[model samples]
Target: MSAAQRLHQYLRDARRRRSVDLALTLLPWLAPVALLIARWQGATPAWIALLVGLCLIGAIAWRHGSRLDTPWLIRRLNALRTDMDDSADLLFAREEGLRGLQRLQQAWLRQRIETAPTTELRPAWSRRRALVSLLLAALALAAVALWPAAPTSAALDRLSPSPQIAAAPGQPRLVQQALRIDSPAYTALPPRNEPSLEGRVAEGARLRWTLRFQPQPDAVALVFHDGQRLALSRAGEDWSAQRVMTKSLLYRIEATAAPQAQTRRLYRIDVTPDRAPQLRVLEPDRGLSLMTPGQKAWPLAFEASDDYGLAGNARLRITLAQGSGENITFREQFVSVRGSGGARLKRYQHRLDLAALGFAVGDDLIVQLAVDDNRAPKPQSALSPSLILRWPADLGSEATGIEGMVKTTLPAYFRSQRQIIIDAEALIAQRRKLDGEHFLKRSDEIGVDQRLLRLRYGQFLGEEAEGEPKLPTSDSEQTPDDAHPAEAGASAKTEAHDDHDDHGHAPDAKPAVFGEEGSVLEQYGHTHDHAEAATLLDPQTRKLLKSALDEMWQSELHLRQGHPQQALPYAYKALAFIKQVQQASRIYLARVGPELPPIDETRRLSGEREGLARRGDELRAATASDPTLTALWRELEPGAGGTASASIDYAALERWLREHDERVPDPLAFAAALAALRDQPECASCRAQLRGLLWPLLNRPAASVRPRDGGDASDRRYFDALQQARP
Candidate 1:
């Protein structure tokens, strides 16, 4: 091979290039040797220069390439290889030609040996260079040995976690965190002008946040607590401890030195169950619901449990509630329980009676179940099961529903219009009496009932709209059993047990049964809206119902105004609605009708209308106008406590008034009896009743009864009478 080709091949040697490449081959050993020599001399400048040189070389090498082909290393290693007997046959001419035939070798190697044209034979000079090189090598070695070794590096700098502290009784976890208190705490929100906490973990807990103001809380106590983390340290107000690991965690936070004008401060802490025990009230995702009275009911159940064994003596207790007398709408045990599940999961159940629990469906019973886990360190949980313990409303409370105004005069906006004239007149009158404000205030409380009466009566006055579409006749609207007269079963209205289902499922669904010959099923077998057809006395059937109600409301006004006598006819008018409204209203009327409710004119007998008893308002008005009505009024609402004589006077008044002989001129006699009301004796309550008749008879304007100097004695008496009479 050509000499150039050989050199090229030697430089390009792949794996061996690191040990054989040109520049890399020569520089590494030389650089290290130079560095060692300077370092031995303790030469700061030389060392710095070498460092700079190495850095520059490294930068250049990094930017371009890295080849650790140390030339001296390869030369020494190659020399050894050549010396080895097994490898000596590869070369002969190059070394020997250079050693012997000066001219041919020089001619052949001149390009390689560019620096020197000749070799002068000088053994002494060779020995001197060797000695000098040895001295330099020795000095480099000594310098390297004396130089200081590089300083050792260190591990990362960070805070270490600490063991959890013991918790206080009734505490979830007393997590104490060290807060960085470089500055005072202040609120960022309004009331915003307050002190701030420089290093509080959680800004504040929802329920129990106590950031003190004057003498700030303990710098490192009750650090801070949110739902999850209890930060006990700070990174500019972050106080959570390093990440905590546990199956469950509890957090507790509060202020330290809290009471005596403490300054605003914050804290945070975290607790792991493994290191510390924490207690918490196991709460329900939903709340408890119970059945209302007279409603269809189902089973009721309650339960409670805990994490640590026997969060001791966890028992459920029920309260009847102060006002809820005997309204337990259940049929079975108040609290029956079942046990199963790995944990002692006990359920207290009660089969409810749908008729008595007067509670509302959405209302919950505050059934509390308390637990105490008597540990050497006692632990307790305020956990309770907030179960919705009731049947659906359709099955629970049988609800009762009753078939369920302002005006001011104003001047007309336009002068030319007649309606405008009336409004203006009203406006003038209103302004003279009271401003709209006061007038509206009066409207809020006063005489509006009269309008209500008018509307109500007008509604009743309307006939069950003539020719309106009537509901189809069906079993649901009638009693087929009523026609049979000999059915051998309970009325379908009364619920029963142990019944088979025709739909082939269960009788519990309140399934409709086949109609008997004359049963309710037969009568109302098909009417879905039975209330319309079956309720014959309802507004649909009786338009008079509304009128009757109006009369009653009028009667109340009359009675309140002390015109008990005038109130009588209205009472009787009201009494008309008894059968007209419903059986219940009718029953109530029947009960109260035996004696008038200390009202006006109830004692008055209806005069004949040619041949029939006068009916409704005309009759009521007639009775109210008569002396006999005045007499009966006296008896019911006796004046001067004259009930003794008032009763006789009323009876007489009734008889005479019924005589209706305009020719007898005996109306004066009834008048005389009324005039003599002061002579007879009666209790004060009844006497007041008699006096009650005057005002409504007079139709005086109504007024608000303010508390009197006598400390509401009269009002109390009247209200007391009403209470006793009604319930």
Candidate 2:
């Protein structure tokens, strides 16, 4: 290639490298600028900023390209390489049109250019510039991302217009206004002065308002939306009022001038309530822990927090349950624990020595923390979930008799009938030592044990367990049939059937033969009507068991009525019957069903649903709308054709607002919007404001859309191919 062609190629390479360096230096700035714009404006503005940045970058690249043209390259080549004898332009001149001297010069320069290195013609990369640009961009991005949001009240102060002081001629016009707030001591917040009347303050904060009028009025008062009116004390030209902020509300200034009038705008005061303390247990990992061998101490950690300051000390309530069965003893004690940290949050640590608390095997120690906040008069308190440390009892082995028969032993914790009798006898022996009330209480407790033991035996006899026992008037009034109603019903039905023969003969009719009694039933019908033969137990034994249940019931009735002495006789008798029933020989077991195949261990707990389909939940959308709110929105909407002065049902709307004030996001703002619309119904901005507030409160109708079905692999492949074939 000729020198001009080679130089052209060199210039092309230089321009490409310069363009890349320029992009590296400039394009990185797009991210930080876009983020800054997004924070100031919104997403759409950020996109516009990016586009503008790109256009500026392109313009700078064009200017830089113009400065590095062929002429500029020729100058740089001549200045750096004097050996070419300043004849570099001759290389680019058209050879045929050039003069003899120029043509000869071009040929000589081309020969020299090929021998000399062309590396000097290339542009240097802006490495430092690019690095600095990237560093600045990253710093800017971090600063923007970490910037905190402005306070809500500060933003509202900027958005909401200040109350207008100008009024009609002869009316009392507000000249100046100032509001000061002093937060409660518990909050430890400094007092602040609000520039506007509408603002928020902490609960129990003292709020003082001072207002001056251009012309002195007869009287001035603050009228709240809840129908409460506070008369401001007049002192010279200024009127002042002070109150403790307890709840959020809207209020307007009312001045009794020549003609009584109130301020058209409603100011808002929002109160932030103090939250209750929150207690969380951090140690032990789990609520229930078992004591291991040689383990002596249980370490516990707790963290408590409150919006304001917390009380000085927290209470740790420990309950120890010792002993077993009906005689279990529970001892509760409270320990005051001091915590460390700031007033808002504190951490508590305590280690419990198991042996120090008299905790033995088969005993449980339940511990809970109760924390309180610094709210005055009545501090709000919270209790943590109970945690238990248990020393588990030893589970005894089951006894086995001869012939591979297993004898089931009752758990020691379970109260037996004999235990109930023993408890009653002991209470009767201490009756003279105890007061009437204490004696009665002990008797009542024993009665509960007796009732529980009776229910346990009733389960073996196939009796339906009832919540409360039915007490008979007297032992003489109770009968066996009353205790076993099912048996009584079966017996009554059998007697009725026997009175009516299968042949429909009269009661006095003679039999066909002497041995023909129940002959028809024997040949045609099967008989299962005999209640005595229904069970494996003999009739006499069954009768004895039924009598024991009746005796136990009688004992429970007297014991529950606080008469342990009267119940002792029946309790002893029931225990004797139970012993007799236990000593009887012959116990029968029911026949078992056929055994099935064993379960697959691999599939157990695998969470596999091979053939099962998921059931979709039926979600019923909330579509109910308040009629009052809907009507108000319709009237306030643009082009509704309602005049600005159109009459509204203020009473009805007020009633609705009062009923649902809690559900409203900002009750003060809602009330102010409503009042503004009522004051100037024709004002377009007022209508718009009220409409905006009401839009979110109105419920939308639920859409009825058919769900799309999930297709198979073949269907998906077909769709993918179709998309690929699209233009």
Candidate 3:
């Protein structure tokens, strides 16, 4: 062969060697991955494992083989052969394309390569790495082979079968059983069969049970835990029954021959419910958005998710609220927007054109997204929270005073006291239509609005904003007549002041000055002893305002307690008092200092300290403990120690649980525990379960350090003698 042919053969051999080395280096790592996939699938077929393995090998070969081309082999050959002068590429090139100098160099290189060894051209292989990887792969395979397999339907059936009862030798025995589940169409799941009688299925799925018994009984039926029975019709040699799964329950098979008998073992069926679609708005971060000038379109994005799948299209409810106040007009329109994403989660986006929606200044464009899940019969739907795009109205500036003071009015969106009263009345009217929980929630929301308004008004009286008003004191709890005695006294004083104004002068009254009236100290001195003297209103108006604040406090209290009906009376009274204060005239007068009363020297240090006693420390009683729960706890305590009761009054304990069920963390679980304990009185675990459930319900004692016990008589006498000796 020529020098070029020998070089070509050598390059071909090197490429094969490189491919083999790569395959060997990668096989161990890829084998573990394929094995892990097969194990995760749980008893995957051999054909599937083979196909996955072939695909992985093919991918590795195609990716690594592409790098082992002729140019790469030539580069390796040049790097290994020092005498070639880096002209290995010329040997592969066509002789006709080679120039004079290249031709001369190729001839020289070919002569040198003809005698060069081909073994030196092969790529280096790491024998130690390959050996270690092979060892690890072998160990991994052994571990996987020995690992316990996941439990299948057949295994479950073997573990939980009908109880073995010793009956007559001719009694029928269950030969074969099969449960076929047909899931709902919306779930897009194919029908499947399970050999186990106890299995979890999707809600609303149809379950068909088929059982063949040797020497068939006259009749067969399924008895459920809820006291319901389903009879199975005889078909050929098998008994079959079908029902739609709705809830989780336990059931047992019953067969009747000459003597009827029910299986002692109960089969459990767990149902997974279909959840409603949840819609979340993603574009507008806040519920309320202000429209800026020159804005043309409002873009909205929403995401809806469901356990099964979301519908193809979602409804965008758009409501245009125009104008302001009671005269406002609302125009509602719904737009269908197609969603794009996986079946479980879908995203819908819509860009609303401002011009098409007829959005204008002083108008609000409210939009909410409504989505439905792919549930059959009637799909459960959800509505996103309403997002308002407000185009605020322009309020012109008012330059009224010489200093150009700009006056601003309250926002029109601010809810007023009258609106609160109206909402309370409307809620009362709709109480019969709403459920108890929803009604209470609505009442509480209105109460929150009322509290915010009360806090705003309190700002005028220099009161700090608080979450809840202080509980009414004994003085505040009195009737209006008794609570507002200052009103009566102020009215009487006003009448006397009016009488003075009517007459030119009184016999005992001094003449009034223009700036300094009533007393000479009032014009120059400042006194804060009386709250009414520093206000801009007269005593009578201040009293009315104070009464209004107290009424508001009462209204807020009842409203927050979900008693809108009881709060209406206080609300109306507060409104009436507020109206009176609004209509009262502002009487601006000079600051007045009170006249000093003459000191009584006889009463000042006479040492006649009668009717006075030192203040004593008052003690509050701790919360009372429930005796029924205590007795139940004592009876349920584990182990044979500590005065544990022999028997418990379960009826009394049940009554107490019913009364305080709201306070229990999980009342249903607690009831289940009680029932379990009652049915299995001798069970130790049952007793422990009941005790655990009862422990949380019992009243927690105050976390105070236990007081040290009083010493014996002799120790007390010694301490007393020591005290006497010290003196």
Residue 84, candidate 1: Cα error in Å is 99
CA lDDT for candidate 1: 0.38
Give the top-scoring candidate (lDDT): 2
State each model's CA lDDT, in order: 0.38, 0.76, 0.73
Off by over 4 Å in 3: 25-45, 48-63, 93-100, 117-119, 126-160, 165-201, 210-215, 223-229, 233-238, 247-254, 258-272, 279-286, 292-360, 374-378, 396-727
List model 2 lDDT by residue over 1-727, tens digit each.
Answer: 6666778887887777777778779898899889878876678999998999999998887667656787878887888888779878887888679988888888888898777766567778889999999999899888888886423333422222235654678888776777777788878886666767768899999988887776788888898887789999988777889999889989988887623334655778989999889889999789999999998998889999998889879899999999765788999998888898999999988888878899888899999999999888789999999999998875452223453433355432277788887888888889889999988878877776776677567655545334312222343223354343432332222222322133221222234454665766544443433443346466677778888999999998999899988898998899899888887634556689999999879987888988676668576766456777767776765776546337578778877888998778987777887777677777788778878888888887667767877599999999999999998
For each candidate in turn, give its C-alpha RMSD to the true structure in angstroms.
36.3, 32.4, 23.6
- Indicate whether candidate 1 or candidate 3 has the larger lDDT: 3
The full ranking of all candidates by TM-score, starting with the best, is 3, 2, 1
Q: Which residue pairs in candidate 2 have backbone atoms (N, alpha carbon, C) closer than 3 angstroms, thus clashing?
A: 644-681, 644-682
Which 10 consecutive positions of candidate 2 have the poorest summed lDDT? 498-507
Residue 696 C-alpha lDDT in model 1: 46
Off by over 4 Å in 2: 1-164, 257-262, 323-328, 397-625, 643-645, 699-727
